[model samples]
Target: MKDKFEFAHGEASVIQLKDISASGRARLLDMAFARLRFSLFVMPVVSVVFVWYYGKINEDYRVLIWSALYCCAALVTFLILRLYREDQKKQSSEWLLITWLPRIQLVAAFHGLGLMVLLPMVSHTATIEFKYLFTLTLAAIVAGNATHQAPMLSVFNCFLIFSWHCTVLLMPWSFSSHWQFIMPLSVLYGIGMFKHALTSHRFFVRMIWLEEEGSRLAENFKLAKNAAETALSDKNQFLTTASHDLRQPMQAMGFLIESIIRRNIDAGLKRSLDDLKQSVRLATQMFNSLLDLSRIEAGAVDIKLRPVNLNSLIDDIALIFREEAVNRNLDLRTWNRKEKVFVIADETLLRQSITNLMHNALRYTKKGKILIATRVRGSCWEVGVWDTGMGVAIDDKEHIYSPFFRNEHAWRIDSAGHGLGLAVVARSAKFMNATYGFTSSEGRGSHFWLRLPAANSIDFSPQGLAVNNLFEEIKDFSRLTGSCLIIDDDPHVCVAWESLLWSWGVRTKCAPSGALALAVIQAGFQPQVIFCDQRLRSGESGFDVLRSLLHLYPEAHGAMISGEFNSRELEHAESEGYLVLHKPLEPDQLYAILSRWLQLKQN
Candidate 1:
């Protein structure tokens, strides 16, 4: 057996594998195996039927011929099955194809030849029936097996020519003169079949190539997508880490400067200190703006939607810019309808977006009035800011909302602008599902607007009155007194908070970790306010520390402070009902919170 297999491999390599490449040989093998398997299964039953029918007409030698044909078919089936099994072992794909494909084709050729040989043996009395059966069987082979054998077109052509010649030879030429015409037509049909098989072979090869290419492209696309996602994740992490590390010293500097400004000094020296403070504030604002843009691009901004009073929201935004506009001697006017207008939106984001538009308006318009107004348009409300400044050119309008893209006109107007405000506005508006655009003509002015879906009217009068009276109930910070506890891993942050708190006439204690804060509380230092950093040096979160201390000191007003702004952390802190302060806390903001806590304690 081993010797026979070795001989077969040698013959296959010389005859077929030498003529065709490895892939072509493999494909031919696949096609041959499929056709052979189908023939092996169906041909025996067909042979039995043919024998029984012919035996009724010629019983003498019909059994002998059928037995011979059956035994030949059985041998071929056994040989083909064994080859197929050997192929399945995958010893060597190239060797298997070369060895087995010829065997499969040889078996198919014999099966066709055997059927052709049987046609002439049928009795002449049943010539019509014999003709019908022969033609039907030939047609079946041409239609079904021809296409599957296309990968080896030579085998298909050989089968077609053999079947056609056999049919022509068995024709009853003496009985009918027209039978002479059948030979020529049979030749034409065989030619057509061979042509079709060639076409099918080309098409099959093309399809295989296309399928392989598509699979390769899909795999490449998946790898590229994974790499891009990993890069984006790394960028977000770096920004988060950098923001936290950079803000610690900035926070300390802000508090120290505030303490100095509060002391008695000459007017000129006070002006110098105030100028230094303004510079610090400007730096902080630019840093925060860049951070905001990064967060928005990283998909870290969360939108919280509720029914918002558009009129009041606009009023609040206008108030924030009114002082800045006044300092520049520009009129900041807000015009809204007498009736309340409401829209469903994230109030904080909506406010920020509109504030960005107002800031741009105030920055560009040196002397012209800035008008912020609301108007109804169809089913939407348009909150627009119009500034009589140098309008945008035609080409600049398209790229105006891109990050860090400043127009020539804008550059001349304010070198301090980082060109991120409008980018943030565009991103935030999209997040809230609001549409924003502008109408401008150069040398006239630009009107930037945001359109929001209008909601059904409801009474916001009570809420408006409560908001109006919030600042009226302020407590003087000097009268407020409370001891505060600070938990932060950064020594600079701890020192900054403690100094700022003590300067406000409040007693303060500091701990570097949650365990140490617990120790301080155990030592009987009761704090009215507890401020914790969100991230610590010991790989523990400030939230965990706050939770632990709150359990021990439930009466303490707890707040989480950090330099970095993350949506997940913000949501977590809010859900836990803890006040969150961003890093580089302003002195007035700290005093306000402490005074509120102190007032609550007194009550």
Candidate 2:
């Protein structure tokens, strides 16, 4: 049984009073009480008809009195039942006894014997017509009680017994020839209906038990759903906190290393430092990608759809990630780089998607070559990431894009990954309305591709534009002279940021909090750019810090820097036209922003 009602073993052969759960039994009793309301109305009316029809010929005042008395009893029962249903309903749940038998036999006796008394009263001094009237009415009242009140088995049996006693007391031949047949037939009707009431009572109780059971299950399901949501929320919070903690040190290391590598250091030491910096940067990237997957799913990522230079975008990605491939001692090569490709895309989403693909290839590939290439397909251009990594098994192919789901072979290779790389790719591809697919042999390797519609506006060659961009970039970077303010509670972060900005030909001041940043502004320091951390150790918000600093210097271009990739604060800022940047900010990304700000200042 999927769900079995707790039924106690008792003396009764047919559905014992104790043979069900307390709540189940209470539900059955509630139905019995409801049916009593209808019975109260019917019984009074039955008495009225009996008195009106018989009073004309007999002129019996006693019958009228009895009728009045019965009607009054019904009225009183109606009021009591109504009050119980409305006010005492909570108490009634406890009325299901240890055996689930109610203590309402007194009430049942009063109602049933009230109808029973009428039959005997009429049969004694009445004609055959009056006798027929009383007998038929008594039969109807008994049948009605059996049909509705059968769940209360003890009450219904009392009703039948009282009626049977009346029939036996008037056993002699007092009926007309036409009505003589009804006397014996009433006994048989009672027997048949008695058996029916027994069967029906059990079924009625079973149905009530099932209904209560279903309600209990629904409540349980609701609690489980709430618990699951809370757990998922906690998991996300834990990841966010962990990411924030890890990024603080990485940000310091990133800035300090970049600052050191900028000097004329030995080539061998510079190369080693480069490797360490790349490792920290990639670790931060992986965590950000995981957060990115969540943002795409939540519909939080803003799609900046535009005509993007595919060749330029891929080359930039290739440049940033090539160090990882070199560290892995793997051949990382790009093909058709000069095809001068262009496509309609969200650059961030497309870049993240391709980066994840390349990351997966790097993480899994132990030997051979990994190829990042472009192929012109029918009506679309496909970017493919091919590798000689361990491929997905035939069985695991279907769930390859599932978050945190990893196959045995893949887990064996890289257990550190939460298996979110492909998930990010799938979600990004879906959001961009692009088609992505993959092919792999279990032992050999895998090839993943994202196919995007080729842009119609491919008039200018990216190579010429690339040359002009290089010249403009160097000029922008070299002329990067401005006063910048950085607000962060971490001491190392503040010092490192100051070092990196000062090296970029920009005068900088780093504050441990918003108040300090304000103090710096008040001390005659006017900043052109502001970078504030979202969460500070002093519990002050980056937004609050920016507002205060900007109030002092309204012309400053401020942005919130956070380890959280898609935090609600950053999303709100982005939507409101404020700039937001992620933590462990790559030198180029920060320099690019500063370069643009400088160019704007010059213009």
Candidate 3:
């Protein structure tokens, strides 16, 4: 009842009105009664005008009597609305029957009485008056009973009776002389009523069918939701296992790279070594992307709101995709607002959204252009990215924001994407309370736009410093000496982890399940650090093995790893005295954590 009903559906409106706020419903009822009363009061005045005009023409008294009777019926209708309004307040069925039912019966009796009395005066034939008045009596029965019970049926019958009267009136000699046309017209009216009755029956059937369809749709939605939840859970488990296993090889790779740099080697060999190191860096970037995507989808990423420079964000995105654009022979262009504009948003998420857009643009546009632009529109700042390439179809626009929903067109070009780019962008925009939408025409191009509230608190003056300089103070620790224990269920994960770590010259021991890891640990072997996956095969868990290690070696430092971005389990692990690591762990992140741990030990 609190929700407005101005543009609501008919059935929704009826239900809403049926249970409206008492004061509002009373006011509405009073209004309806007032209109009915006014109509009844004006009837005599209108009838006098008509009577005066016809007084010189027919000199008949039937019109006056009929007009008076109609006025009386209108007064009864007004009283009925008033009584019904009062009936709404009374909960006792006995009170409603004692007061309201009698009033309705009296109204119906009056209508039947008037029709019987007036029709005989108009036409002196008992048969004609009897037939017409009987029809009116049937109509009155429908009206008085229909309003309170079986209302749709009552209303339908009312329309049928009125239609029959109008059709009889239209016959050539119906009012004056010949009763011949009455027989055929009566037959036609009966046929029409039969057809209407059949239609009413069909309406009920359709209503039942629609209800069944709605229930089926609701059931399907629940199943789909559960399936999506299960898939996400499995993905997170894999990521956790992979991250723990990967740390071993990444640590070894860093150790090897650092050791090689200190060796007595020529410049050419060192340069080749640097290339290998860069390849590791690339792998680390990919690993970070996977983790970031997982965390964003799992809603584990906490967004912090701060004043962000719109122009700077767009420029950074354009720069990131510049090489890709150039390689594809696409022009990468950017335009900024004349004045510096700031918006309150999460800068990291904003950057990620823009980056996704730029990546998508560059990926699709082979020989055209990718443009990033920003402008002030009324109260909002609109940031847009456009790509001139094979555009999206009209039907694909509605589904583009769904997770893992790649358009057929995008799949044709490159099917490598997991279809999460736009989904991330949409989620980020919603979290920031920003507006996001895209426009695409067939065979032309696509343009995506995000509008955010312009913020007044941020400093937008250019710093004239590149983002690369932001990390200049960060030192590299390529030559780290350590041994690690990696536990995971997946063999491919173990292979990748070991290779990455061996490249860094760190010794490693890997076990596919926690039971096997426990067996190895019991034989008197322990690494400097231990990394265990949360989910292991054979119903054995990393937490179980880690607990066993802690009991055996009380001073051992351990980290629990998961591929999933869901941090609830990780948080629980951290609370239980374990360092928690997210899956798809980057080489840099692994190095950073190990470097800090080693430094603490050395100190």
Candidate 4:
């Protein structure tokens, strides 16, 4: 066998040192082999054409021998190529280099000696026109070899040798004594073609290397995308667990504080209790804002749309912030037309958006009254919170809506502010299909507004507004008369629920698990309302516990209380027609549930 393709000269150092992979080498072989197979069939016709052209005029049978030898060479290359293809399927592509490289060199030999050298010796073309015509045919064949054989220089050089053979011997035989003058030009053209093939070979190898590099980069990008998604999922889970743990105690303390403030105590102590209550509410706002931003980033915020009464919503928000506004020596006021304005929006998201605006207004405004106003526009309602204090600078306006972004001026006033309040507002407005913007002058004040689409109350009753908004108002809890079933794993949380419900004249049967709650039912304690906490210590969610109890008491009202804002269980509870209340539990929300039960009982 002949030496390998690497024996060819005029290649770059990288390719000569085996830098071209086995697959790259195989691709080159595939292209060359395809051309060889096609040429084998065409060469027989070429031999026929050669014998037909010269044999009629010249009385030479030697031409037939040359044609026979050329056809034989084609036939031998065809048989070996077919055998190579059959075995190539079962073997690695590297076999093309180890086994087929030597065969390709032999294929070149057939074109050189078997066809080129024998052409001039046997076929005597007396006419100069036909002699040049034969030379043109050989030159065309030389050009075709450059296309297929350029991948391997060893094979390319072998095929290229024929052009020199024509220049040195065949052309001279055809031209007679006139050959010496034309010989130099033919040799120069032959040398140019040889150099061109070397460049083409380098280009082919460079393309193969790039293909391998691109494939590796694509795989790495895919792995990185998967890893980022997994890390985001893990972060969401950790936040959910930690939020629930911290909210359990916060919920219990809120209940205990509300229970204390309800009793007849000294005026001085009652004022102190009210102050502490305002402090808790402020802390709850900050915690909820941060958690909300995290949930939105994790793609866990699923906004639910519904009809919301702007009048009732504004009233509730005014009540929540009024206490803090008083402590800050600022007048907190709300104004709207006596008419009950309705809007199509997600009540939860709308409430948060407005609350963030209100909280932001309160944080910046140290003096002057804060006004929460609602206005009717064409096809929409605009609710705005106007405050008078240190207003935003012109440059800070653009980035104010971004999460955790605070300017130097505002940071000095409220060092504890996380800047998430306005960010939550922006996201909540987008999710609810509402729009919000602000107008502010530095050191004067800011007026932030949220606009929502006007919705007709014909689809839903106007009187049912209070029934829908669980956080509306803290009415006379003495009116709440119903038996409550509380399911929670934390002992402090259960006690807080019991004390708060008892104060509201709600008879309660508390249990730590679903099985124990069933035991209470077995003992003949029927409940009118069931309040279950999500993420129980028994590995059963509030939805799982309430599912069994709700089936047993179809007519009874049931609700889920949990601090997790983004959870499948929270979504599942709401889907099953149960009201899902997030912690720390609001006194007004529980009262809303109990009030509905009392109405049902009385009817």
Candidate 5:
């Protein structure tokens, strides 16, 4: 799965190969196998030589007995080696170490020096035959060291000492002269080999275990690293979605409170409420900026490019803040060269970018005027937002598009922003494949421009559907309203939305759960509009509820409200022609949606 091994469906199941362990046990076992193979090759040659030497000497029966014993030992050693080979084919390293190591060592030792003990007994018939026994003893010692590890070597040497003792005691007077010296040497060699074998066995066992542990640790660390990365990614995504969704309701609340305070007809109360509303709005904006950055980083924002009218868009911008501009005695004007500038772009995203620039300009500007203009320049039209505000220094220009970076002037003037507005604008420009730049003079003004390639021929033709302030239609929603079903698990959200809707003269039926909403529907409470939250307390989501309701009330307009901007939700809602309201809804935003819905219902 990780591009390590490309295994077929059944390959892994059938071929259960050993995984490499950090321990040297596997290597040690391989070395032991090699030694056995070499011993097997030498065994027959030595056996035949002993048989030939005995036959040529015309020795007594004793020599024949020694030769026969040597042959039998060699044959048994060879059989053991063959058995070991077969076992190696089936046994894993762990199995070999635990079950076969001790047995193999003892067998190898016995065969290695067993015949050498019978050598002195044949001296009466032929001393030459006794010389052959010594040669066989030396060979066994060497072969034992090579094939079987430590314990086997020790056994080999110990058996050689024991056999040599028996041979010396049985020796005839003619060969008894050197028996004492020969017996001691044999015992010393055997004891030394056994000691060394013991040491080797312990070392191999330790090394093997260490290898296994190292491999397991490596695997665990890899898994932990992947999990940490995944967690961080999810955290960033959650923060982004939460911020965006929270902004809508917060912005709506701010606007509504501001509007209510403005109509207070008392200057003191109006000022207080306005301040409160401004604080709320600023908080909402900061959260929205954070959300935007998160969404962009998560690769969740998708631009829906469509043919949009530049003039109409500019008009909408002007209308959104015309009152605020007028209130501050700042002139807001649009200079669109009397031709239609249509572009292939995401209308909402384009609006956001332009609005951010406008808002940023307005925030710093205490003065003369702000201008928005669009004109064809070569194959693209440059749409500009110019403001007489505290402009950027040349040094700070590049960094303005960096998130959380505020210029010295901006910090001195208004440091409230998350400093992500220009960054979002820049990312949007890149996403749309549009070019954007700014010309600014410190203490004088700044002009930000976006260049979008024209889509279709520029049509200056005007349409009557244009309204001066689309937001104005929202305030008049109370005049014509019907029963609205509110679905959300959060009681606070339900209460707030109901309060807002009641002012619009709408009768409300509320359900805290999707199942309850279904029960309400079954109880003959068919509302004209439905608002549902995306996540419910249980595993059920707003979509699940909407689907169920749609089956029963096909004509009922269902809208999903959430604190997340999921692509799946957007696409599904778009296909169904359902409105998606993100959280912290602004009155104007809510109004805009309601007005549109009301118009659709009328149609």
Candidate 6:
């Protein structure tokens, strides 16, 4: 019983293997059929040529017999082409192996049989010619059919067996001394052709499979790319909206804090308020830095290049950091050749880059001094920040400029540092076409530097500064009085503007939209200065509002303010001759601009 069960199990395994092989061949038949069409077309032409040449040389009735056979073969080949074309339209693989492939094998068999029959008829007068013609015809058929037909090994083997038998039978066995050699060589050639056909078939199948897979992968990649782009666009839009909405409340808080600090309060209360102000300032700085990095990543930061005075720029940086350095008990200093050094660069970007470097230096250094200086290095000026701090290790140096990448020492020193300062500096420096690098020795110090092309001749006339001096030359807002209009969708921002401007002794009115601003102007309230938010409610923009208001009040000086850093809006505002400000606006900066506008109106 055990021996009988083993025999039954072996029979079942053989049957299963046969079924698997049949299914695999069925899957490949469609591709093989397509390749067979090329060989079919070539076979008819070769057949007709051989018949015509044989007929011309012999001038016998055998020409007509062979010509009829060739015609029959041509008709079958034409029918096969037609049938395959029709089958391809349906894309049905069901009947391909059983029906179409057999028909193709029948045509190949007919060609082989026709060649064998033609050989004996021409053997008498056309011995050498028959040998040459038969060999060439056999070679052409083998070469042409092998790649397409070899996928079905049984069909290929059938054709090869018939062709080799025909060639061996045609050899001059009775008289030729080399018949033995010739017969063996012909059999070997047939075996070699079979081997070559198997290789070509496998290569063809592999290449076709790869082509199909590659096409699928390409389609998937396209879909992924589109999805990623859409996500990025949505993220940028969210950032823009969030920045605007968040800054409105922050602007209000800043204005309220400044107004309270300016009041005559108790010394203790004033000190507490000062601390609160510092906290607010720090929050504002971090928020702005985050937004700046976002804008840089979103490709929204525009570079506006102009001649800048290195001395004046360095002086401003020192002034800004002077108090901070004092609080830290660190000396912040600048060094340069006594004369003014000039460079053509985007002043805002250059300043931001240098300032970020300065902030980074201050953040890292504990007790040692920080130096902001410039020196001529060949044809370029190297503006650098040298800090006596715990310098970065070699392992950490490469990643120090990457966003949110901090060394263990840095995290220990200040966990609050977002590690964005150097990243901003790197991006800004790149945007301005400047090369930035750093040299550091662990536990001693680090020197971060930016190399900018130096201007040969100085333009004595100073460039228009983004923000004018407020403390040294405090404008008398009390001496000047004018009506100012504030158009912003955010009520908190409008209230903040009103509170600050009213305290400066200027008459102020606020509107939420372009239509509302137009109504206010139509009511015969013409303001001397107009402050418009870049984005208003109800699908309105500051540009439209400004245009409508300006039509009524042409002499009013217009300024655009926004929390979002959109390069398009900035470019438009700049082109339209509007002063641009980002929020939460600095009290000194706002006062400086307002004082200047009010004084100009009075003048």
- TM-score of each prediction: 0.56, 0.59, 0.45, 0.66, 0.48, 0.60
Candidate 4 per-residue lDDT, tens place, 1-603, comes to 121223233653344416657877888777766665566657778878767877676867666787787678778877887788886887887776788878877777666655566446643544565566666776677667676677776776877775455545566666776688766777776777777767677667666766876887888888888888888778877877799897888778878887887773688897798778766765665566567657767877666566777888787689888889999999999998787787888766787788888888898888998999999878889999999989889898899899899999887888988989998888888888888899998988888998999877523221222234524445445546668899998999888888887777778889999999999998998998888888888988679889899899988877787788767877676655567777876676566656756653342
Best by TM-score: 4
- lDDT (tens digit, per residue) of candidate 6 on 1-603: 000111132253212212323335554565554555555556557666766777667777775677666667667777877877787566555555667667766655665666566656666656565556677677767766676676555556556656656667666742155567677777777778877776765554444444555776899999998898788777877887788887888778877777676653688897788778766755665576566656666777556555677777777678778899999999888898787787767766787788889888898899889999999888989999999998989999889899999988888998878988898788878878889999999998899999998877643221233432212223243434889999988877778777777766678899998888878888988898898888777788787777778777788877778787665866677776667777877666677677666773444
Clashing pairs in 1: none
Q: Give the residue spans of candidate 5 off by over 4 A.
A: 1-41, 49-71, 74-102, 115-207, 222-491, 498-559, 564-570, 584-603
lDDT, candidates in the order shown:
0.71, 0.71, 0.60, 0.75, 0.64, 0.71
- Model 1 — which ten-residue stretch has the worst lDDT? 1-10
lDDT of 6 at 574: 71
Q: Supply the global lDDT for candidate 5.
A: 0.64
Cα error, residue 335 of model 4, in Å, equals: 8.4
TM for candidate 1 is 0.56
Q: Per-residue error at 472 for model 6, in Å?
A: 9.4
How would you encode candidate 1's per-residue C-alpha lDDT over 1-603 as one tens digit per residue? 000111132253222223334565576667755765676567667667766766677656754475467567777787768767776676666777667666666766666676666555543444556556756777777767668877666566556656555666666642254566666776677777766776676555545544555777898998998888888878877887788787788778887777676663778798788778766755664566566556666778545555677886676567567788889999889999898788767665777788899888888887888899999889888999999988889999999899999988888889999999999789878877899999888877899999888877542332221111112212344645778999988777677777776666678899988888888989999988898888887778888788788878888888888887765775587666667777766565667667767853353
Q: How high is the lDDT of residue 140 in model 4?
A: 72
Q: TM-score order of candidates, best first?
A: 4, 6, 2, 1, 5, 3
How many clashes show up per model?
Answer: 0, 2, 19, 0, 16, 0
Relative to the unseen true structure, what is the C-alpha lDDT of residue 80 in candidate 4, on a scale of 0 to 100?
Answer: 83
Q: Which segments of model 1 are wrong by more than 4 Å?
A: 1-32, 36-75, 78-99, 112-144, 152-192, 229-243, 246-382, 385-485, 494-529, 538-558, 563-578, 584-588, 598-603
Stretches of model 3 off by over 4 angstroms after superposition: 1-324, 332-352, 359-426, 429-478, 482-527, 533-557, 564-569, 597-603
Of the two candidates 4 and 6, the one with more favorable TM-score, higher being better, is 4
Worst 10 residues of 4 by lDDT: 458-467
lDDT of 5 by residue, 1-603 (tens): 000222243454221113334124446655554564455456556656655666677545654565566566567766866787787788776776666657655654554445444454545565554474654555464536533643223333434444443444454443566656655665565556555555555454444544665777888888898887688688776685455445545644654574465346877786687567656744564555566556656677655555677877787677677888998889999898676668766655677789898888888898889999998879887889999988888889888789888877677777788798898789888888889999999889999989988877532121111111122223234343677888776666666666666666567788988889888978988787787877777668678787778777788777777667665864586567566655555565566566555543342
lDDT score for candidate 2 against the true structure? 0.71
Where is the poorest 10-residue window by lDDT in model 3? 464-473
After TM-score superposition, the amount by which residue 114's alpha carbon in candidate 4 deviates from its true location, in angstroms, is: 3.2
